[model samples]
Target: MVSTRTPGFSRPRGRFTGRTRTPAPTSAGPSSRPDRPRLGLISRDVPRQRRENTFPPTPDRLNPAHLASLRSVQLLGCAIAAGWAAAFPIISDLPNQRLWGAVAAPAYALAGLLCLILPRRFAARSAAAVGLLGAVLVPLALLALQGRHQSEVMVVERSAHLLLTTGSPYLQHPVVVTDYDPYLPAMTLFGMPRQLLGNGDALTRVAGDARIWFALTFLACLLASWRLLRPSRDRAPLLPLAVLTASPLIALALAVGGVDLPLIGVCCLAMALAERDRTVGAGLVLALACTLKWTAWPALPVAVLLLWRLYGRRPAARTGLIAVGVSLAVILPSALTRADALREQVVRFPLGLTAIRTPAGSPLPGKVLAGFGPTGHTVSLALMTMGGIGVAIWLLARPPVSAIAAADLLAAGLAIAFMLAPAGRFGYLALPVVLVIWPRMAARRWSGKPPVPPGPVGRRPRPERPEPALPRG
Candidate 1:
């Protein structure tokens, strides 16, 4: 042993006498093998930092060309809307004001030029802000002008007054305007607060300025829609916001003080709520919208579909019931008070034997078809009905998987209705178009990663199991 055995090897005794064994390694004072290179502090820390789940990775920025295009389109919309709104009051108020309508064209062109000269990076936000400001200011300015011109606002004001005093808004014809109180009873509610505060002063009554109220409401709706529909981690909501805020039809509708804005607002809010899984709230709001006008009726079926998809058949049926109850609660009082008159005015007037005329700048295919007389009108109506039915069937066949999809389908249904309507304003199509397009654009931009599908409401996701460790050599 002294002459030949290795230090770590031992000769076996007794039963193991025939074999020699090597001793196992003892304490690891240092690696017995050759010295290995050490990782520096930066290299060690970097991987450790990545392993920690404290921070999320940064999102990619939008493309420069896409951003620029978005900004340009937004600016153009804002400029046009602002110019149209500014010109509307002048043209409508002054005796020979139609001449001033031409002034808006040049003003819009100049605004567009100015917007183009600004830095491209900030252009969309700047333009959107400008448009939003214009939307607010233009209506306020019109209200302040106190033009005393005959408008839908006057109809609402007078109807509200008549409802309070004469017990029937349809009994007396409003001053100079003669469509016979086609508005729903809930519409009078909006005008009542201001009229009731007037204390019977004629000037105060006429100055109720429902247009201002409607414009403010519409603005709020646009903001809410933008917030609800905007994609996570994206900053390009400006274009969609601008498109809605700066629409010429929307501007015109606001300028004219039409009652359509409230309907649009309520419908939009309902859709937003439904998207957020607030089924009961959405149902209540949708009911409120239905109380305002017939415009929201087409959305009801879509709402049902959304509820069914989100919460099964029972909840969907319950929501529909709630909606119907709310609508009846609002509508029944007026209907009971003046059943025949309300029916004739609200229903007969809108869909009577008389031929309906399209709005002045209507671009509906129906408008073109209407030029061919009775047969054309019939064809237009039939086509519109068929188209609407087709869309409904399509929706039923392929139910939407998300709130955004539901909205798109609902908007599509509304668009079909607007296009087919025997009489409709171009503005009627604006909300639907924006609702359909904005979400799509946002989705397209933020689709770099596949979205994590949401779990059913109130349920937690299953946790993933840890992987088995790899064997070391």
Candidate 2:
């Protein structure tokens, strides 16, 4: 990188050789001219300064060695992920006795190893592309290959079939049964693909729908990563993209049927848009994501606060109001139809609490916090408070990142709270948490001032040798 600090600001070399002047000191004593200070107004007629001609060419995006190293690193990560997915038969098993764990195994392995080995610049771009493609293709493949194997994926298919074939909304009512989970409603909208396909088992249709959703979400994540990393201005966590893409939890969400992928994609979109100064868009995205899964609500506050920080309080307030107004316009209809049902599912059922059990049947952190109870509306409230504190401190120490990190960290904390709560479902939320840390763990390309190399102990900078004046000709 070229030095940002320009030279010749301190002293001119041979530029002033042809034109020079001497200043006389101000008169003192009896003839003192105090009003006219002896400040130098020296003039120089020299026009051919050497410093003016010095212009280093712009550097290439990345050196060949760097790119090669990144590729190797990514290759190794894929290998390890593949090995783990293959060797660990316990976790990699598919829902219906099918096992395509082998495919994911390599993809994840490559991701992990590349994260460790590749340089930040190359890794960020590569991981973004790979992660996005892997997220989309892997899920599609699983859904296509293993239809009706998983219960939720089956539910999604059945829901679509009931809607399409029977022309009945009752199928939608089944999703109401799990109102505590709003993702089903969002999934319902994409039944167009299933409508095209003739009567197949509910399993096949849902799988198809799911595959598309996963693909879309993956594409969103990929786009976000690319947009965030392309300019490479500030320090962004590249590893986060890898983690977001390659986490086993994400794979599990795809293998089974869950809202994690969609929520993740929306969250990413919101953050990216916010960074680009599209607060209204970010707010709408966050609002839509929250509708899919209440877990995304934390992002709302974070986004608002970030807007406030980025653009003064008044503008931030306006943005927040607009976002809320738009979100309600979109979500209010669905929520209204099932107002009583939603109340029973979300509020009365203590959907407000985090007593949900993990896959292994352990109480998530949110559950424990929920035990604190009535004082806080839900575990999200408590977790949000804690996460908010940490975020506030971080922002105070250093300004908030385009609000993306704030949203991400909130998600990570929420995931942890869910895991620690009495009934945390590790399957769906774990991936978001894992993804939140990816950028922090991975190195990013630096585009600021060039770094200073370590000098010998206690040694000072040596004086630059002055060039000898050319012989008079």
- Residue-level lDDT of model 1, residues 1-473, one tens digit each, is 13333343343211111123222232234683232222211123444433232222223245322543655564656565556746655645433123224333444454466578778656555555555444434443544365433356666877788888887676533232265666777777767756756635545543456765676666676566556644443354556555455455654455545468777766766666665566687788778778777768766767777768777887678778888888898888778888876886676554422433322445677666766777887887888789888997988897765556766777888888777766655667866865665544545432223244222312222323333444544
How big is the positional error of residue 3 in model 1, measured in Å on the Cα after superposition? 35
lDDT of 2 by residue, 1-473 (tens): 43433344344222111124322222234464443222222122313242222222123244322443455555664565466556645653444323535456555655565566678666655654555456435654555654543454444555465546654212223233332333424455544465566448756555456545654675466456445523333344344444445545555455545445666666666655555567667666766766555566666766666666666776567657776776677556656665654444444443443333223333455555555656534544556567656755654564445533654556655665565444455565654654453322221222212122222212222335444444444
Q: Where's the lowest-lDDT run of ten residues in candidate 1?
A: 12-21
How displaced is residue 204 in candidate 1, in Å? 6.5
Q: Estimate each model's TM-score.
A: 0.70, 0.59
For all candidates in order, the CA lDDT equals 0.59, 0.50
RMSD (Cα, Å) of model 2 = 13.0
| Top candidate (lDDT) | 1
User: Which run of 10 residues does model 2 get worst, by summed lDDT?
Assistant: 448-457
Instruction: Count backbone overlaps in model 2.
Output: 32
The reply for model 1, stretches above 4 Å from the true place, is: 1-107, 132-136, 148-150, 172-177, 199-207, 226-243, 355-363, 438-450, 453-473
